[model samples]
Target: MARLLVTPATGALPVTAGGMTLSLTDPGCITSLAPWRGAGMALSKALRAAHGVDFPDPGRISTSGTTRCLWAGRDQAFLVGPAPDSAALADHAALTDQSDAWAVMRLDGPGARDVLARLTPLDLRAQVFEPGHTARTLLGQMNAVLSRDAANGYEIMVFRSMTATALHELTEAMKSVTAQGGADPSPG
Candidate 1:
């Protein structure tokens, strides 16, 4: 009999091109929290009590300490980082462990937005997609959760099975952005 070991989606290493870098990020734990009908408020309260994070509005990401509550879609949010108090949340919402279902990656550096622009249709301009803004969007052909976690930085989450494809797409975009004289150095 042989034993197996778990591995990160991107080999747990950084990939760089044209001054930009992409790396795997361990968010600790990811839990899907879907509120039951009419229990939205209670779920929010329970989340606050458990993680100190408010339920996020559509297209927003809320954070407290290392925990982030991101609006995943209508009536659904994902709590990334730290395990939630399931007992406290069970009455208000359905809780499912999603830690192994996703591959979280961090993209950063000067031309990061430009690199992402090649893959997604959403506007990446800072004025429009400021830090803490998040969206359910397409990254190339895969479904992804995109968030502007900081200026010149983004957090991209996709299905664990699609990580290789995601990496290929982003790398190609990074190369293209680099070839096209690189990203504009101005802050927008």
Candidate 2:
């Protein structure tokens, strides 16, 4: 019997495109934190002490030290950083690993939001959806967790199976944005 081994290929992900820098990221950890029954306060506090970030408010993202937390759902958020393997996590909340279940796409540039707007229903205005914002929104029919990493950058997380579709949508949208003069490179 012959068996072929296939490893995840980082090179397969797309690269920078016109007016936008798009790349896939594999975070070291994506741990979900949810209160066990009525331990919301305790779990929130424990996560703060352990990861240095309070449980993010709904539709928000919080970062501290080397860890970043993004709101996942009602009373739940995902911590991306060191794996939640320490003893402290056992006493905090129900923990689950989602690192391998999703693909992280980073889009940053002058027109990152413009590109996203073409694909998602999200209103990517800097005023209402500025940095530190996190929301579960739809991107070209895919359910995605969108987080603003900076004023000109965002992290879009889609199910692993949808990575291809997400990339295609984002790429096409970026092309449209660039064509519309959102990212012209011509010098005056």
Candidate 3:
């Protein structure tokens, strides 16, 4: 018998008014583990001992090389790496598979910030929201996390259902900003 391979739909949603593009990836395999159940103070120490790196507190850990860790919550952390061996990490803490529960969307282009600003209250100034930093913020009234992927790109995390709305809002925002610049006849 041939084994059947099922793949989830992964593609870019339609562009909105602002030229903001929302591209979706394979429902990134997520392995959630609770690391602070025991000695909260030593969670980082324990994580380092087990994973070879310190557990980054929310918005602190930087993506160094192949693997990057994000603090998903106070006691929870999400590891972004080559297909995770959740079983290996389960030996130390409770591991939950969240691959299908969340969606990763990449927002890029010049007007990225303007589009995001319209939805989020967080200050996204380059000097403020530098690269490699991540923050859990609301997007268009929906709770989601945004990561600064690059100088002009952001990786947004939102529930599967809100993907459509989020994309729409971002696109509209990007278009509005673009229009403002081009509407000005005089070039500075």
Candidate 4:
């Protein structure tokens, strides 16, 4: 089996060559509503009144269908899409360009959550970590935004500077899990 190697700052982690692949990229097309500073109650209310759906609670929102919104922090939320319709959500809160400020790493493998559990405090058990669910938590002591991208994969977001460290930690965890030959506890 191909090993999960840690990449240097400018290097991209291999994403398609092994049991698990990690790809690092600059999501230039994405934008974050992170700067819209306000209380959660106000934002949720505005979103519900405007969009006809309740704004999801923090660590909740699934990324399945078109246009999913997630609470990235107490005062910030992130909208993920081929193109974020900031204007639609802007009517209720503030929007800012976070495309250039963050690095997105896509992690895919049967042991993906095993790698994540070592870094994040959130429970990665199948019963709890399901598709469309998201959580803003710390990964390897650094703030990270995570979402399950598929039944056996995840997408982890962190600041640009912390990317290398996050990858290193994840790689180590995956190795440990593979050595033990344990099945991933996450549900499909």
Highest lDDT model number: 1
The clash count for each model shown is 0, 0, 4, 4
Ranking by lDDT: 1, 2, 4, 3
**What digit string (tens of lDDT, one per residue) describes model 4 on residues 1-188?**
12222245637466343377777744434445543445456656655554443456677763434555666776566665545455556655677666555668888877777777778999877678787678888898999889885787787888777777777777777777777774465454
The ten-residue window of minimal lDDT in model 3 covers: 1-10
Which candidate, 1 or 2, has the higher TM-score?
Answer: 1
The CA lDDT of each predicted structure is 0.88, 0.79, 0.65, 0.66
lDDT per residue, candidate 3, 78-156, as tens digits? Answer: 7665455544455556766666566777877666777787799998887778787788889988888788877778888
Q: Candidate 2: worst 10 consecutive residues by lDDT? A: 1-10
User: Can you write out model 2's per-residue Cα lDDT over 30-128, one digit (the tens) per residue?
Assistant: 888887888877877888787788888899878886789889999788989777855887676888888877788799888888788777898777778
- Whose lDDT is higher: candidate 2's or candidate 3's? 2
Q: Which candidate is the best by TM-score?
A: 1
lDDT of 1 at 85: 91
Per-residue lDDT of 38 in model 2: 85
Candidate 4: where is the Cα deviation over 4 Å?
Answer: 1-10, 15-18, 25-28, 34-54, 62-66, 82-91, 182-188
RMSD of 4: 6.4
Residue 172, model 3, lDDT: 70
Against the true structure, candidate 3 reaches a TM-score of 0.76
Scanning candidate 4 in windows of ten residues, the lowest lDDT window is 1-10
RMSD of 3: 4.9
Q: After superposition, how far is residue 153 of candidate 3 from its true place, in Å?
A: 1.3
- Tens-digit lDDT string for candidate 1 (95-121): 888888888889999999988988999
Off by over 4 Å in 2: 1-14, 183-188
